[model samples]
Target: MRATVNQGPVDIDCRPTLPNITVMLYKDGQQIIPDFDKILPIQKKGFLLNDVSFEDSGIYYCQANNYTRTIILTVQDDSTYLSEPEIQIPSNTHFVLGSPFSLLCMLNISKNMSQSNTKLEWVLPPSAEV
Candidate 1:
């Protein structure tokens, strides 16, 4: 999964355990770990990188003997493109006695639906009819 900067301790897995597992981690083309930690293989068969930053974004490679796995890691800024919605519910309304009263509620999701696949709905009161 892609993570934002300062958002994670990313774990890259090392697969195909041998009798003696010696895993090495590489980022881009440079090696990160020369020697595997003693407890890494026993604990999770992976490496946990704490508080990843933008500089940590690259193609990660896990090499253990001949078996290897590669992953593309993209780090993004925490800023969001969408702002809080401005809700405008009427503050005051007056109706005469025995007069029919109707209320309308509207929600705008135009900015939030660009990348979303989920649906949004508003439920009406049980006594209300459309």
Candidate 2:
């Protein structure tokens, strides 16, 4: 499922909705329940995110007792109304020790995305090894 950042929340629930079964949630590959800030109680069964972000977009796993279900979440940027920005780095690279090289960040934006609200910013690492 796809959701827009700062627009609407996303919800997921177990199909069977067992009474005594304990529901657990996982984002990407890590457990995020209890510690997640956006989690909210669902209709007596499952949970929902109050506000989603690009980082929240990933494979969501729900473990209820022995039953497990997965949901793929694709969060869109509110500004551009597009999916998360993708940074592509070529495999082969040529860089001089002290020379400056330009890095390009790429993202797949469709016609539905807003061009005027899109802004790109580059962040540098705190320290460089070389």
Candidate 3:
């Protein structure tokens, strides 16, 4: 997984949920305590990393019972990009209750960044449906 500095509150999910399971998260072999402001537990099934920075990049371990999974997170500096990407929403957009609407996002990738390295993502409100 790749994230940019200050770009999250990112969630790392533990799959194959089981009954009454407890998940433990670790960074570089050190267990992450929920009380920490940067990384926290999420419903005993995953973790959330907030205010991500380059130091947060490393091997992550998610353990449950006897199963363990490894995740590699790479955090990049904002300077990796020449400039912030631009987003343009249609003018005068409106929607009625219970109606469906679509949004278009346009991004301009810097010449130094490859297509695979540049991604456009939409984060919806918590109440919004996929």
Candidate 4:
């Protein structure tokens, strides 16, 4: 997931509604407390990150019961790119156990920027399967 600086009141939802389920959100491995201004709890279902900034860019984990879903949010500065790149990701990052999943990263660089100089990379978690 990618967002421009100051781009939202973005909502990050946790899925597969279960009865009496409680969702907890974590940022960069640290549990996030709802500060209302920055992180807002969404009825124990997920979180809403308000007024996103560059510092908000990080890996978010939505944990419920023993299941966990991971989201990598990249907050880009609009001034750095001629146009913001389009990113597509699954709404639900959680996968069934032993199931295969794929991730895609694509960029639409501006003509003004040198294509040879532009680079796209994926920084995967150490435990991630290739």
Instruction: List the candidates' TM-scores in order.
Output: 0.50, 0.53, 0.54, 0.55
> Of the pair 2 and 3, which is ahead by lDDT?
3
User: For residue 40, what is the lDDT in candidate 3?
Assistant: 69
lDDT of 3 at 28: 97
- lDDT per residue for candidate 2 within 51-80, as digits (tens), equals 677777788888777788888888766555
Which one wins on lDDT? 4
lDDT (Cα, tens digit) per residue for candidate 4, span 1-130: 5433547677787653775787888889998878888887777357888888778888888888889888888886554574455667779688777888676656877656788888676677999776
User: Relative to the true structure, how large is the alpha-carbon lDDT of every model?
Assistant: 0.61, 0.70, 0.74, 0.75
Estimate the Cα RMSD of every predicted model relative to the unseen true structure.
9.9, 10.6, 12.1, 14.9
Candidate 4 CA-lDDT value: 0.75
Residue runs of model 2 more than 4 Å from their true location after superposition: 1-6, 35-37, 82-130
Off by over 4 Å in 3: 1-6, 82-130
Number of the candidate with higher lDDT, 1 or 2: 2
Which lDDT tens digits does candidate 1 get at residues 1-130? Answer: 3433435766666554764677777888788853343213334456766666677788888887878888777765344223344445457878667777665644344443554653445667999655
Q: lDDT tens string, model 3, 4-64?
A: 3546777777654775887888889998877767776667447888888778888888888
TM-score of 4: 0.55
Ordering by TM-score: 4, 3, 2, 1
